[model samples]
Target: MWHLYQFPLCPFSRKVRLALGEKGVSFEMLREHPWEARDEFFAFNPAGRTPVLHHGPKGITLIDSQAICEYFEETVDKSPLILGTAANRAEIRRLVALFDENFFADVTLPLLHERMKKRLVLRAPPDSKLLRQAMRLAHEHLDYIDWLVDNRRWLAGAQLSLADLTAAAQISVVDYLGGVDWSGHEGSHGWYRVIKSRPSFRPLLSEKMEGIAPPSQYADVNA
Candidate 1:
């Protein structure tokens, strides 16, 4: 069986989880506290981040959620979610970068970790000023998504790809904290309603923090 080291609330880790579920692959889930930076965890990936995939066959570790997802989709022939052509792959990669870069840095990280870090005292609190800037920037990113969603069913394209999974993971985390401006961006709002409504999204929605109660809709899948 494969092993995935992840945290309870990291969006990057959720990306890998969604990919695994979409492929119907079962694996062991090991919860890791990334802030502590344990030596055993570092042995798997020097970056010392969560969501590291360990393939039992090769006993090798893969860092980065996107890399792990692509590896599984490419090497495992069961159900490939990747695009057939190089051009399609480029678009997928672009969408992934859009989420990992601007969406994450601007929206999820700031709203959750910054304004709400007090709820999770385990890690060092995020910078206050950066958090403020992140909130402003996130609205701009959401505005961009609103425009894109006006055209396509999915964030990247017509098919439900890892790009949707990527955005779902990020947005879901914030949704848990009641951060999304659900009424402002109808396109994005509708898209998330579908993505989060999926059967694969169940486990993510079911997740709950020790002292934190996700808004009632966090588990609704339809919300």
Candidate 2:
């Protein structure tokens, strides 16, 4: 059996969980906070990150969300997340990188630092100025998502892929922190609604972080 070490609000961890869920892989969860800097956790990943996948009997440990997702994609044949033509696969990878890097940096990371880490670790009030800035950036990102949804069936192409999982994971975290403003982005909002309704996304919606409460609409698939 595989044990996934992750905290509730970790977007990368959520991405891995979504991929595993869609691929029909069963694993146990081990809540881990990277900020705690536990020695045992560091042993599993020298970088000391969450979402480390460990197989005790097989002695296999996977670190990094992209690497772990790819590991499963290659090994498991049930659901192919990076499927389609080479161009389509490339598009999937590109969008995955966009969400995992650009969107996270512009929106999710700021929200995590201001909303989550501040409240939990620093015990300080969130910065309103920074929060506003993050929300503005979020709108920008959502605009791009709106454009993509308008153009394609999914973020990458026709079929559901890792790109959708990656974007949804990041967006879910932002929405949890109350950073998303879906007013002008109907296309993105509709797309997100569909993603949120997926069975693979249900577990994430039900989970919560200590000292934090998601907006009521965060868990409502119909909203």
Candidate 3:
């Protein structure tokens, strides 16, 4: 069985989880509070990040969400969530990379570090500058998504590839923080509602921060 080192809250970890579900791979969760850095888990990943997968060889550790997801896609079965075509593969990778780099760098991380982290861990709120920047970047990112959903059934196009999972995972994190103004875009919200309703996405929607009540629609995958 594949062993996954993950926390319930990390979006990076969550992406891998979604990918695993899309690929129909079964994995055992080895939950970790990576900040504490136990020697056992630390030994597996020197970087101390979540979504580290142990597969095949006992000691081989899979690091980075994209790398792990692509490796599995290449090596495993399940109808090729991606493609053998260069153009198609590049498009999927481009969206995946964009969501990780552009969206997370400009939007998601700032909000997560500034707002959600403090709320979840009972720490003082982060800088207002961070929140302002995150809010601006977040809205910009969502507008781009609204256009994509308006133009295509999924991010990057149809056929339910890693592109969709990548965007969904990113959006899920924002939803958890109530950072998403779902009512702003009926189409994106409706698309998300459908994605959330999927069996794989059901587990993601159910995730809640400790001591924090998510919005009513959080678990209402159909909503």
Candidate 4:
């Protein structure tokens, strides 16, 4: 009986959704447009962000994707998303930070602001210059991911961790905007394909935003 307020395209929200699905936790998803700053939503989370979770069993509300996912890991204890020994956990957390902070800062946020948030929420024209910059940075981020997957089985290491879900959540949003050029990044593309094929990822792949058509390959695991 968990309730999650989330925007379909928001990476942070998507990350939590992926985590919940991967862990076999069922919850109700309430679509919220945070830009509207609804008062009811604010009552639940003062920060007014999506991906806020209401844990029915404990009657506690959780804000922030990182906190919610970690709390689920600690409470659920079924499928281990963040696995391995202390050192391995450290590495996994490092990569999680890399994508959640570094990748989003350089690529996801900027691109979404220009291509999505501006037009859909703000009702403003896209910034061409910023869009171009974000596109370039997106490719660089992809290259970095290619390098990482080239070395490790997953983003962090052999086991599938939060790092993989975190990175995929962000990248999938960008890919929906046609920002990802998956032609050359063979390693990363293959890794993504594997993740995309998972049953947990099916719901996300089926999502289609209003007035925004994703690329043909956006939902294709074999693409």
lDDT of 4 at 108: 88
**Top model by lDDT, which number?**
2
Residue pairs clashing, model 1? none
Query: What would the TM-scores of all predictions be?
Result: 0.90, 0.98, 0.90, 0.95
Model 2 CA deviation exceeding 4 Å by range: none
Residues 43-155, model 2: lDDT tens digits: 87999987899999999999999999999999999889999999989999999999999999989999999999998999999889988888998999999999999999999
Tally clashes: model 2.
Answer: 0
Model 4 TM-score?
0.95
lDDT for model 2 comes to 0.94
Error of 3 at 169 (Å): 0.4
Q: Identify the superior model by lDDT, candidate 2 or candidate 3.
A: 2
- Give the least accurate 10-residue stretch of model 4, judged by summed lDDT: 114-123
lDDT (Cα, tens digit) per residue for candidate 1, span 17-127: 888888988888888878778998888789888888888798778899888988888777765567658887788789888997778877887776754565576456657
Q: Per-residue lDDT of 1-223 in model 4, one digit per residue for the tens? A: 8888987789999999999999999999888988889999999888988889997788899899989988988988888988899898888888888888988988888878888887787888888888788888888888988899888889888889999999999999999988888778898899999999988899999987776788999999899
Clashes of 1: 0
Q: Give me the displacement of residue 204 in model 1, in angstroms.
A: 0.6
